[model samples]
Target: MTASRARLAGSTALVTGGSDGVGLEIVRMLADAGADVIMPVRNRAKGEAAIERIRETVRDARIVLHDLDLARLDSVDALTAGLREEAAIDICVLNAGVVLLGDRRRHLTADGFELHFQTNFLGHAALIRGILPLLERSRARVVVQTSIAAARARIDWNDLNGARRYSPYRAYAASKLALSLFGLELARRSGRITVNLSHPGVVPGTAIAAPVRALLPQDLVNWAVHRVGNAPATAAQTAFDAATSEADAPVMFAPSGPFGLWGAPVPRAPFRRFLDADAAARVWREVDRLLS
Candidate 1:
């Protein structure tokens, strides 16, 4: 039963940030299920190495890489050009992101926008917009990797690009928060494709844990965190579920453990408060204005 559910057989998927950690795990699982995986990577050599690793174990893992620097909208454009030239995509996973420690200094993206907001959310949003025709062509499912941090943020139209002020962590968290809000709203606006937001519990060994560990004094604090945290491979299972499962769910899946902190893809609806149709509309309007 599980094998059948895992089977992609001939479907095509694009996994951004498929080079390492949680993203690598996801690519492996998808390839094992017979997906022709498209990896849009910042570094081509690193992506080749990751594909080799997957092929070593999964054999015949259909994986291809397209040079994509999500930080650059132009790169995003090039990636779509290459992908459209290939075949229709069945799944587009917006998984690549970075959390630069701007302890006291502010950084910017190639487009001159706040680094985190531009890369983490806006870049992917542009990717989605650019690929809309392809998505419609393939009837694709879009998966946005949102984080638990989103629960701590609300859409801020006034300073979305952090024109007024910026804190590295706030910028990172806000970017992720904005993605979730957009994912929910995007789904509400366009029902032609299924758009889902997911939180892959506390996978402590992953880069997401790096920010938290940076502030800790002891190395043990970091080691202990990964030891007790969710496994990277397991953390991606929910993403796999969202991309493949035919479950009829109204809300996105927040796959964590019993406490919503660690584990597999357990069924979940996002907070009911987030379900307010009006709020979802407002999110769409504000983000559209900010990015426009």
Candidate 2:
């Protein structure tokens, strides 16, 4: 609601993980703006329920739900193919991700890449590639949801899978870093399509917080989360801006409050590494190889 809710009227949008959290907020806002939203949910029932909730407010909302498992590349392909059969897409939001704080052990996807790496980074890479033609047809804006944690992360180029060293936070940070690279590189490569990255900042209500909360006392956890985390709608502003704004702004959008934690959306420089075109290109090449 911070931005113009009617900005995307008469458009088509595809959002990953639209079932909950900031993604759900984005879906709702887009639907309110009169966009035909295509949501790829892992759980069809949960997706239908979210659509029902949105319908309560936007009675004429247009939402199409498709089954997608980002952990599996085949699922990504299925979604891309389905999208191609429809009209050109105006937006694609890669927002689904996970933080394996509940399990410190390194887990791999069916394709053998680290779980977070594959789900957060590689899956998105493959998806954008498969849907490149549709994006080209519409000159779509691609918004990748990254994290502020990515600013502190270093892509362990030598041990991309965390085989040598791994921690819950480290793995998640690396995946975000990779995603940032992909967004920047994609923008550089394709002039017809607009690509941007956004960080929702600290949205404590998000499911990624579930694993960490399990380790803390209920009362203390609730108090701490309330103090540090912005509401999902507030955090979602940066993402919404990146997706719908027409301003010729920086490609990275983040929260505008203290330490980029909470406020309205604003464009900011990403990490220093993200500025390096060479590094971005390198990551893109690596991602392309993995997806191949």
Candidate 3:
């Protein structure tokens, strides 16, 4: 086994959204690297298929699936409770997310929050809170998947739920920005756990690119994706590197290609907003209050 993979022989990783896209790729990489992987899925059939696919490449891959729906806090709580029984969790990748470009109308979760805000940011926030003890005990490497969209978005303090004015892209970007801020704050607050951020450079087949695919001609979209965007597996490398890195200082791993869209994963400076300590603290407080 490679040196990196060998280092993870006895490690355990919990990955959210591991049933598909870049999340699935991260799970496969962890399993191949000799880490036991636990994936929380919203669908049993899909989760089983993902495990089957992983076992195809690693005959003795150790993987477990738990039911989770990031849109619902109760589901997040159940998964966290089950995971608390584990001995240790060495790595946690908060990667599950949703983009609602397909539907322009505003949607709310059962918790009565904006769909994107709750699923992408708030739910993950709640999960982190629930598992903070495990993470601290294990000194786990926690990697949060963020997006380039976060750089361009700003939180609407007055309308966090987008109840006043709504747009698909705005809601999605805001959620990512909030998530990014939370990651930064977590890094500052937890000296025991190593917290890092990752941006899976644009990958066309992923949900984030669904709108682009629908609007462009098939051939053109394919060409653009090949020329400028990464494939899911390629994009996943950023998060994988962040999760396994020995760096004590927090860093944001992102693509090194042109316009930061495609290429090898490398450490990059976080966007200015991501470094706003005041903003990060505010986000943490707001999420805590909302979850409580």
Best candidate per lDDT, number?
3
lDDT-better candidate, 2 vs 3 = 3
Q: Ten-residue segment with the worst summed lDDT in candidate 1?
A: 247-256
lDDT of 1 by residue, 1-292 (tens): 1366457888999898899988998899889888889998999999999999888878878898889887888898887776667668888888888877535577777788787887888888878877777887787788888777666666556777777777777788888877766676777666567776667877777776776776777777757666566787887887887787675343456555665777667768775545667766776676567557
Error of 3 at 98 (Å): 0.2
Q: Residue 273 deviation, candidate 2, in Å?
A: 2.4
| Residue-level lDDT for 146 in candidate 2 | 89
TM-scores, in order shown?
0.90, 0.93, 0.97
Which wins on TM-score, candidate 1 or candidate 3? 3
By descending TM-score, how would the candidates be arranged?
3, 2, 1
**What ranges in model 2 sit over 4 Å off?**
1-4, 215-217
Per-model tally of clashing residue pairs: 0, 0, 0
Error of 3 at 54 (Å): 1.3
Residue 158 C-alpha lDDT in model 2: 90
Q: Write the per-residue lDDT of candidate 2 for residues 1-292, one digit (tens) a residue.
A: 2235776778999989889888888888888887899999999999999989888888888999998999998898888888779887998899999887778899988877899998888888888999898898898899999887788888888998889998878899889888988888888888788888888887776767777678889997888677776788777777778888675434788878888887677888776867878888999889867776
Model 1's TM-score against the true structure: 0.90
Task: Give me the runs in candidate 3 sitting further than 4 Å from their true place.
Answer: 1-4
Q: Evaluate model 3: give its TM-score.
A: 0.97
lDDT of each: 0.77, 0.84, 0.91
Candidate 3 per-residue C-alpha lDDT over 153-174 given as tens digits, one digit per residue, 9 for 90 to 100 = 9899999989889998999999
Ranking of all predicted structures according to lDDT, beginning with the best and ending with the worst: 3, 2, 1
Query: What is candidate 2's CA lDDT for residue 138?
Result: 94
